[model samples]
Target: MGISNILEPIQIGSMTLRNRVLMGSMHVGFEKLEDGVERLAAFYAERARGEVGLIVTGGAAVCQEGGMGDQYCNVYMDEHIEPLRVITAAVHEAEGKIALQLFHAGRYTNQDATGVESVAPSALQAPINRHKPREMNATDIERTIQSFADGAVRAKKAGFDAVEIMGSEGYLINQFLSPVTNKREDEWGGDFTRRARFGVEVSKRVRAAVGPDFPVIFRMSGLDLVPDSTTMEETLQFAVLIEQAGVSALNVGIGWHESKVPTIAMMVPRGAYVWVAQQVKEAVKIPVIASNRINDLRQAEAIIQEGRSDMVSMARPLLADSQIVRKSREGLFDEVNTCIACNQACLDHIFDGKIASCMVNPVVGREKEWALIPAEVSKKVAVVGAGPAGLEAARVLAERGHQVVIFEKQNQVGGQLNYARQVPGKEEFNETLRYYRAQLDKLGVEVRLETAATADSLSDEGFEEVVVATGVIPRRPEIPGVDLPHVVSYDRVFEKQAKVGRRVAIVGAGGIACDLSHLLVQDQVVSPQSAQYLLEYRILDAKAVHHLQQSGRKVYMLRRGKHVGTGLGKTTRWAVLANLKRHGVEMVTQIDYKEITAEGVIIRNQEEEQLVQADTVIIAAGATSNDSLYHALQGSLPVHLIGGAKEAGELDAKRAIYEGAAVGRAI
Candidate 1:
């Protein structure tokens, strides 16, 4: 329907939000030991200016022992209150409400990072972190409860509108609630009431400490999403008890650190866990917020309109475009840069102990540094290659009131992005390309298709500035028999220029290799004509569908590294590997390539040398910078190199887009 429901104001306890959109808490690792306060204040202030209903600061550790170990904000003591006030004040100045999420990492925390023994309800080693936690005694339990209350008091003193008790995602409260982690036989475990006691008590204590008037939001896991974890029914029961115990609202999230279910990856469907929030909404009278993979305005609005949730929470979408709410409110949906949930930067960066950034939006965490300002004098700019980098540079330069033109050698824009979209489960990359295209049209950036750019031609055209985003070329490893007709690059396969045989051997273990393997093993029986005529018309039977999904191709992924898909994001690696396994794609790692024969490629490992039987060999070994034009045009014009032309280290879109934007802004 319409987005009126999402734009409508919502109330929780004594606080009234401007809209139903909440910037869900995400760990960005932006906290500093000395001057951390102002950095975070500026970060949230930008989002606040975007007019989000409420901004939930990334989880702030409630106690030193419960800290997340990395660069996380602390709200455990009175000293933290003054520094945190900076964030609350800045958000308030922008007429936005701010909430502090008080968290205890429990078994999910790393002992090496914290330099303290992690504590949980039971002495169990968490599967994901592999951290052995000390079972909480009576004193430790009391202290933990007090820590939550103390954090709440500090939050209130710091001028926070509310305090969200971190109860979900295998945190301290979730650990006690889940049967898989809470294997205790004390008053805090063994039974449903006892197991949920920690969460209930924390909510009650926080509510008491902050007074009955202040809002106390309990972030609950509607379902633990792991084996032997709390079920929907049990979680719903716990929700009821927590509401009665004094929770003003519930922020529902899915899965945990060890959850097998795909939660935030690109493969996960939007609003996949909204049903969990729906069930929780039905069970509790408090406002329910649904989160995880809620990427666009349509999806967020639908969640609220369909009576699934009272509000929608998103972290990645806002990270990609902080103006999501503002833009959507103005009916500028297409202008909004949607999050594709690639997790290439946000979640992956957090896992790698770096500040989280966005793949599509490069100016996420470094908003202050990458702030867009109008140019003093507009100039004619020529950008070579219409890939993500070139397109971004053109868009930014045009936005700065400069005349910009992008020259692409191919018939279409989106350099490798076009090939990227053809890969299985990567159709979302098209959305990013769409954003660039829209921005180009809106900003009046002239695009010339099938036109190769040179410094001589640009100088003849009277272009004042030039940017080279020539992108990359596939790096074919030098080996014997590589000149065979069957040996093709990944680009040929993606462009449908290469005909692959029943048996395929990929010569790389990066993301492209894995994606190619997935593409090769996909069901080949379902033709586009049949899919449109039969499946689209609902004329296909279950047997026919099953037949359409049968694949006869045998694929092998070979790598010199220890692991396949090593270049993949942490959140997506396991899932991609699992898909490869289910499709029976043989992964051969740590292999020394010998030579390619007429039949197959010969390889050597530690034990022996053998031939891998294959009819077609695909070289996805990697890409080298396509900088020949840049090198040739170096002294002719004031040319700035960007994207793959500048560096082809990891083939990361984040770096490409950011570099493009940076160069655009600088010139």
Candidate 2:
């Protein structure tokens, strides 16, 4: 097995996979109704056809009360067995095996939605999961164990090849395993071995119910990633006992629901939990499955080839692109709708009770409803600027049979989007760029680089429609000291202007400031030569709560008012605050910056006057649109201004893609 080699056949109990890829469990809100058999079957079947070796159906609650997490979760009812059969049959038809990961929402289930009392191993409730949980009586515990065993039997009857017991996440089983949540002194708590008793018993009952050949995957968090929760070391030791109880495989996961920086899910890195998986893999001979932000095929292959884990699994990746397996096989990898891990549509919208849709692929859940077979229209069009808006506009127009011409002033296609990929944590921005590049290429759209479109430079275009997607520029504040030698912005840092000193202070709290913080934390800051392209950002909310502030880096979030970071999205805001809080970055909120100098910044916070030191000053105040071209060309045609130019909307992929679609349809 070499590093360049691909994943080979692997065995997990009786069922074997031709490759080591499992279409990880991602609920597209497929079970909104009582019977989600057909919808779920169709969804899994699509991925199977795309060549996935294994399909783990989005979690099915083993019990009705205190079990389900969302409004659309599949139930473990006897009737649900019939639907499970349908899904298993569909996957088998496409030569893919299916596994049922039986789950119990435990305290994570919403009490408001269910109107049921949350039951846990103990009465201690999670701060974020604010449900008044009733301590599990002996009868409740016994019933839960029996219910899990029953669900495994039902899954077997439904034709699922295997069943994985859900112990990962901070669910019922994990809650019992966690010292933070479980405070019981009785049979199920106190000691580490005693704490793991519930999960161990559930596996024992499940194995007994399903018989000897049936493989049971024990899904447990490699690390809870929550304060005072179980770590990977605990998980490793916990696995040894669970394996002794007849577990066939271990499904390694990271973080709990409340954890903003999920161990495996975000923009952290590819295969972030491989080490955790490797640890368990080395300890166990039964094989281990690793899952967390594994989007790259090469990474997955390397994991298997290097024995990091027996297999790799993904949830959101399969939803964003059902044809990922087939596309990868056919070498159309870039064309696959990449999961940017933006929880906006998938988690946020679904929690809000809407269907799961991708920001890039609008036809995610409604793929059957909105699909174009591609028509050959013959209109010639010119798209200005090859940024997200322009790239998307040109791609869609060309797909509709229009002969499109896209012009970008920069050598690269992704304008500010390209620069954003260089920012830490926001690496998902790179995927958005790949999506557009692939989309435009497949549509046969002609992209012209280094072609800056002006009023006079509108040559090679005598078409029916012309789109001015030239994008926007940054706005400089009228403050007098902004023109100083040391003042710079995020754009300059991204462009990599040299001669910037080590210690830096970035001003601002919005997306620009957050990104600069990540960059400055990574030792990338603005220089004097590149100061023209930077932003002068100040903060609005500067309360550090995470360990990111411990990075030994100096970050002073300067604000003129009472609040900072008011513009960040809910989930994104939490992540930024968490990182900033952990890294020991000095935050100076509620301060008015009177001046910027080479040595430091002069500020005013309340009645006190203080000077903050910094070798380089990065500004992130905001951006201004160079919409002069849009105004000049507005009357020449029925033109539309969109995306950032429309309203300083950043490279928020949703805003850009959704707005681009509207512009295309309008045109």
Candidate 3:
């Protein structure tokens, strides 16, 4: 038996994994057109050194002529072989198996590469992809088949253990499979069988090209999850067909990029798509791999334990903490760097043509060379605030073998985190608090709760270094009736028994404001039992109009600016907007607040002035930096103010923690 039974070996055709840990395919964006192969090799080699059982090299485009995105790697031609050889050879040298996920983004291709003349199963254009595809003809189909075969042959020669066909998410194969998209009258359209023909044939050709010994992993959407999309029956049938078409296994996925929510990290819960994998596994004889939000080790064990799927795949989780596997094996799962799913650091950065960085763990993806543990030096350090920044700094300092003490005015750790965790879907942020607490205990850092430190106090203590992590304060908005007992700040919303009326109105469009809206709404939601587990929904039909809307909610937005919610990231923005729109939240932008009365909110918009009725009004405009402690201690002692004091973002948890880690390493 392997560590916690997670390292057990399984077969994909003749290829056997040393362990079930598969470093799922993720775009590193380090691949330049010229240095692509070398960069990819370096990326894979680093993962291989971490003992990644198998490596899936990002999403490699198969046809340079019609499919490619900016700074993306492509194995589209024989010219791409030698460079890919470097990748496979590097992985193998580290005693790891390497596979390539062959991709053709179709309409998802970039305009700069394909000249905007790309084609999907249908001619429908992506809302943001910007590329209008060239519809595929019989010759296009033939060339696509040849392209898959060519890419597969190159994979075999390059020594990939297998090749995963990128068949999900409204890509070419999925477009044909989807009824909402594929409207062609040709043999490739009309029915499920015909719709699956291209994928099945591509698998057959890829297998034939690579010989029977080489495996082909068919990645497909078991359920499109789109409105008016292909049914589950079609997906199951397609799964069986692909299995019989000589594919080694199926990598199950769900939904399309244009669905209610894309990007598995944001919307999907952990094990959110396990049922998809289970359905495919039950429908076919071949092994099935499950992915999409399966981040925790226990959840993964449950999937295999209950026979839901043969293996689990993780991308962002692995990226955030490459040592997760090793740590879990050693019963140190708490030490792992958890993914907050912010998308700001990882997805957004890489997409923006920068190296992928972690929101909290700044040293991520660079662990092979970059060390968060600074050089050996004995220094006494004092970190004030005991918050994300303080703890991160303390942990890093302790790791670097420095004597460190953290001071907090609060009785417990997690300053803002204690409050920030109040948001919906952000309950996991508490994991960081527990992680730091565990680090404090493990590394023996002295934590003095209720010990507020000043520059003079720290100087009297004779510490070598001082870091003021005393975070920010809520910026109070100037408005009438704000001082009344009926009006409470967002921090107080989740702190105590906030008696919000049936008609609740929240002001401000900041992260906390949006989150406070969700917190209040969820508090009002109802969950009825008809089947398995607990359920939840909103009460009073209140939507975070500024954040999102799933169903109709009577959410009132009082905006002081033009855009209601401008500060949110991509994933959060979509969710917030969709939720708000679905709930029919009322929007009143560019409003001057006249007053907050028991009767809703009275404000004047640029267009017109209106007094909306509200049971209660909550404020979430912005935060004020309570720099009194830092400023008082500033010149008095050598104090470095990092994080929120340096920049403004709620996830300053990330900013603060990274600063702490950097300072810890340096000291």
Candidate 4:
């Protein structure tokens, strides 16, 4: 289908966007560095150059007390104006429009970061926050409202194209909108109308301050996805009020931070929350933008053409590939590095209190430092593996005008990522492979599949630089009857080379084990389209579909360690574990492996021996570095090691890709 709807220009208030793609707001933890403003300006300028229709910057705190942290922009302070002005100028110079997102964390604020306790409409304790908030009095509420108005004034003075009032994702305004958090009987929280007064008043005040021409977008929660939250009717009513309050558009956000539903994980289907935005669009005359899990141009175009939304917002996809919009516009969809939504390097890092970057594109936050400039001197380079590390290294080397070749023993690339894609809900890994293939081919990198390059072969090729990213080999744990006919390695199971039985026992309770268990215990594989159809037609409710998604297969996972899924990211571990639990996969930690019998594996937990009844046993203990090739070529040639070859203690694709890119630049 031809792309037309998403590419169409849109007008919001007096600000006209070149296209419907909005680079959504994301906090990258770059707001408080000494040269933070300069870094941020460069970041936005890159996206602007890529021809994104509009950009809404990360939230800037409306007041000190409601601040996310010291790293966030405090618009309440006089010092913020100059920095914001610099950003707006940079964006405008690139011929792009930018919106400043006025923010307040409310009870989500960290006392350690703000040097004060969090304040909210009521003194409710948030599940995600440690600090119980102090209830805001009438004076506090009035002051907070004034602060939002003042922040809008600051944004306009800074030459911003528009301002987005941050009201969603269980922030300050969302707290007032939800009945679960706001228990106050005062004017602010007596009923639905009163509960929504805070956000409406803020929008009204911001509009009053910015004048009618300036764009005022309210990011309202379409569905809190929490218990006893605002109903859809109330949320739509809130949207109507916000529109009446003089907002130019409504950007619909789904789920609260404390909501159990996974909003932006790899498991979430694309455009999963679009219905929420459609409801808001129908409720109000103003344009509505759908957010969350809508990546790529096809999804965006369909959303706009179908009239479900007037626009679409993509935050992480832009981080993965700043040129997503431009590439799609030129019909170079294959070249665009789609966001896998693994959250390994972006959201996971943010939640870990570290600087955020992209797993695929490592140059995201370090754009200036990690630029792939042309090599001063080009040379013939040999990358001795076609996995993540080798693929990236080859791509970068070829891009810098170096003659590059990649050797892989397998018929295809992606290494362990192939297994990852085989797991349910991990279909996005194929995109990584697709991107690498496109990049390598475009850069003229030679790939030799089913051909493993040895030290002698590489030395004979007369390559100046050799990069050894040989990846890793699964560790074979020592146990009685380990090589039994019914026992299989995780790789064999993933490759379908070995047959799994009705009952299965898996060794090692790590990421691989959990994924394998999920795959084996699931009764049927539901494609995203089919799943959406099931829900849309009401053939099966979410709860019933969830029940049907799993099977009664007896799968047991055994781990020697005390914890399961040890190295998983904090944001994704819980969700993965929940899936395992929901599928009835029994995970036993602190177990002593006795032996592998024909019927099943024997384990001793808490000094009690028991037979885990299983027709097949699988081993997924861990991995060891495949550094034999690296060591072989060490003294024979000048070689660099990366990815699993450098460190196999933890299998990390994020570190692998980053290392490959860094090595490529250095060479």
Candidate 5:
């Protein structure tokens, strides 16, 4: 597909962006110190340097009553102007346009963080955070609108090119717009027009504050994606109203924090929400920006070409690879590190009060700290194992002018990732592998496949430094009859080295166990590969569907913990659990493995012991470090151990990749 349209310049009010691609607002939770502001400046500046047209900064509170506290940026006070100017200046130096997303968290604000009672349209409690908000009175509403105007003035003075009024994602403006949250019979809540009055008034006030020539983008939810929330028609009506309210453009966002829908997960198809943007675009004369799940340049370009939306907005994709736009323009599209839609590090970290980072791009959130600079002196480096850690280490080292070689025991790269990709709905991991392969090739790194390397061997090869990313070995839990012929490890199952019988019992209830259970309960006759092919081609083969539906195997996922799949990411855990439930995979939690026999396995629950029949037993208890080479090479040469070799408690690609990148830069 031609990307000429995507690369074309677009005008939003008085500001003319370099291109149609915009970096949507996403919270990173950088510290509020002076240094933190500098770091934030570097973060956005990096993307600007990568040639993004316009960058919408993470949401900043507009008032003391709606402050997100110290963890997030706040412009409610006059003191914030200078610090924020640092970011705007840096972005401008890179020749990039920037917008400030003015926000009010409302009931989503944590009282513990803000030290103020949260306020909302009504007294209803937020669904996710469960914070009961005080109903906003007429005076409070007027004050909030003025606060938004004050925020706009501050943004304009801080050198921002534009301002975005955040009215989506269950925030204050969204709360008043939705009938579910606004239950008042007052003028601001009785009808759709009344409920929408708050957002319109904020937009009008902000436009007035910034002047008519300045761009004001109103970000509103297209579906809300929650029960009792505004419908699509209502959202379209909102689009028209906000356009009439003096906003220069519209950014169509999907879902809310309280929505039950999976808006950002891998299971959702790419551009699944473009229709929402198209509806709003058709309803309003102003340009519409589509947000959510736009991972590739072609997809973004196609959206615009098809007239679905005027511009494409991306958040996590930029976090994954800030240079996506630059790469696409340079025709290095294959080199772009596409976001895999794994919310493990970004969203999960934000919820846990940590700065958001990317699983694939380790330098994110640490742009200044991890800035890549050419090494003054390059040397020969040996990276053992070609998993996430080793590959990352090699990539960085090679980029810094070092001659790097990677040794893999297997015929191919991607150590545990090869097995991980076999899990249903995790095909996106293949993109990570592809990225590594392309990076290694581009960097001219030597990769020796089916070549196991020992410390002595690496030393004999005259390597200046060695990195041990030997990865991990799956643990075989000790049980009385674990040595039986039918007992196998999860890896063996994925490798097709073990034959699973009609009835299978999996030991452990983590991600691996859940994945194995899902795999085992499927029809043994039809390979997942074939099933995926049929699904991808949209060929509704009834026999294949029937075979999947009538899985003959009975699989039990046993866990010692109180809950199954406790280690799964919050965003993906529900989907995995639901798949297991649909397949009737039994989950036996808080169980102790007594013994295993040919007939079955004896297990003990809280109250009593029972014999669960199983023809085959698979152990997914976890893994232990394969660090024998690291230990053997400890004193021989300068060696660094990363990934599973450093810590084998859990399978975390995020830590592994980050450590690898860190070591790569260090060496």
Candidate 6:
């Protein structure tokens, strides 16, 4: 894992980065807080101190119409410049360069959020957005181009090292470039050349406003991932033109926000979109940044060393581990907390108008508040359970100079994550366990595997405080014939202890059921390497690839509710359900559980009884709190119940980890 090209410094125009890693822009929901700029300053400074090559702030709207919401900073407002200076100054004080991303959401804007109708190249509505944007008149186009230029000028005044024009992800400039969105007959549309003019003009104007010496990076879509969208040839054409327009670098992004493709999900292979960036790199003279799903330094190194792209952009990975670069540079690869791409806390929260945080690293935006200083009085603590909650609590407590011990009944850590890792395409769950194990070891926390500690035992061992994070137990339904040998729990199936038949019926279509269904129906696990090979060489046609994706298994998910996969996050639910449908997994909802028979699951839907044929039945009927330890040790010693032991609503690891860390800090 020795890094070469990734760790090497590279020059983008006048800006010489310390390394080739760019902390890419992400909408972290910090800009709307009362002390938003201060929070952002601390956030960026921490990452800068971690030795990231360069930092790009989340998109700052150039105009009001282009603004994502009030939460996003607008460079058009003069009052915003001084506050943004705090961010650049903080990063500069940490000896790191910061870039301002000038953005225009265009048709992607929510009318309620912006208090204005969205605008696009044409009147075509974005599928994701509710309202159709008004077609831009001649004046609106000219004004928007000017807004970008003005925004760049303000960015320079705010002491930013660079400005990246946000042309990608179906934004204003990208809208004009794509024929699907730009159904216009004006000078801005009709053909590819005309369609590409807006982005080129924006880049040209921004470059002129920023001056020749100032760094100006243009972010463009390498692949639209939408039907009848900009083709690879047209994308390359845009890249070449934008390069000629005087941009210093091109940061290539994949898919629009509205695209059905799961670009940044866990199922997506690491460095999967580097090929798109490579295509752009081949077409342009400027430096190209390979983005989307490039998590670790090893992947970034390979991308740069193999000349796929000049640099790599890792946004969520930085969120998961702020010191990713420092850890990798020191050869402490295992210490690096990798982003699982769950999108549970980050993207899902953002989409829900909640403040974005990290699922793995919960103290992302609260850097100032949750600073882990040494404890005043170290105490001996016993954490029961080695799941996400217990592991995190132990790590934090030990780091704060507390003597900590974790007792896991299982032979290994990652209590429920052990089962989660068994799910197909969810192998990244192992990364979370790996990071926790490394952190626990580094902090000198004693982990007793296969040693179940009773409440009395913990008190007898002289532990002052105990954290009960024993996790949850699967709730078996009250149905007839539940004791059949063919019936199995989801955990048993995940553990490979039960023999699952070809025709399987899953009871309860929650997140776990969906994942189990996916596992049962996945014929073969395609490694990222093999997938890339198949894609690069065109070894499989579209039809053949589609065929290869399916398992052809007969699986039925039975649910008593109206919706399946209800426990999944907003950003991930659709993709998981779509994947299940693609693999031919039948999901039936709003049914009353009749009985679990050896032949199949018998259920009645809409007063119609039906026998769902299956050789094996899996019970994923949700979970209940395993708080027996909490109750037994209520007032014996200082005990805090956390994670599933406290509330097993949906087995949310995000909540568990956060609660664990909070208790650790409190202690």
The residue ranges of model 4 lying beyond 4 angstroms of the native Cα positions read 523-552
The C-alpha RMSD in Å for every predicted model, in order, reads: 2.3, 6.8, 4.1, 2.2, 2.5, 2.3
Sort order, lDDT high to low: 6, 4, 5, 1, 3, 2
lDDT, candidates in the order shown:
0.88, 0.74, 0.74, 0.90, 0.88, 0.91
**lDDT per residue, candidate 4, 503-590, as tens digits?**
9999999888988998898747575578789999999999877666665588999999999988788888889999888778999899
lDDT of 5 at 60: 91
Superposed Cα deviation of residue 195, candidate 5 (Å): 1.4
> Compared with the true structure, what per-residue lDDT tens digits does model 1 show for residues 493-604?
9888989999999999888898888888984677656666777678987668756775779999999888888778888899989978988899999989999988899999
Q: Residue-wise lDDT of candidate 3 within 432-491, one digit each (tens)?
A: 787788889999999999887876788898888788788877777888877767777776
lDDT of 4 at 253: 93
* Regions of candidate 1 where Cα sits further than 4 Å from its true position: 527-547
**Candidate 4 C-alpha error for residue 500, in Å:** 0.8
Clashing residue pairs in candidate 5 are: none
Q: Global lDDT for candidate 6?
A: 0.91
Q: List the residue pairs that clash in candidate 1.
A: none
For residues 1-667, write the lDDT of model 2, one tens digit per residue.
2323344777888878777788776657766745455667777787888777788876788887655544545545787777567888888998888888888878787777666787888776667666768899999999999999999999999899988888887888999999988898999999888899999999999999999999888898788888888766778888898888998888887888777564533556777778988998887788788888887666687787777888888777887778876677666667877877767667766656666666666556654434444544566777777777777777767777778888788888987777768766777878778888888878788888987776555533555567776666665666657888788866787778734555677777666676667666654233423333332232212222122222346776765655555655545567766776665566667777788777788787777777788888777777776577678766565466766777675555566666666566555
TM-scores, in order shown?
Answer: 0.96, 0.84, 0.90, 0.97, 0.95, 0.97
Q: Rate residue 324 of model 4 by lDDT.
A: 94
Pick the winner on TM-score between candidates 5 and 6: 6
Ranked by TM-score, the better of candidates 2 and 6 is 6
Superposition TM-score, candidate 1 onto the true structure:
0.96
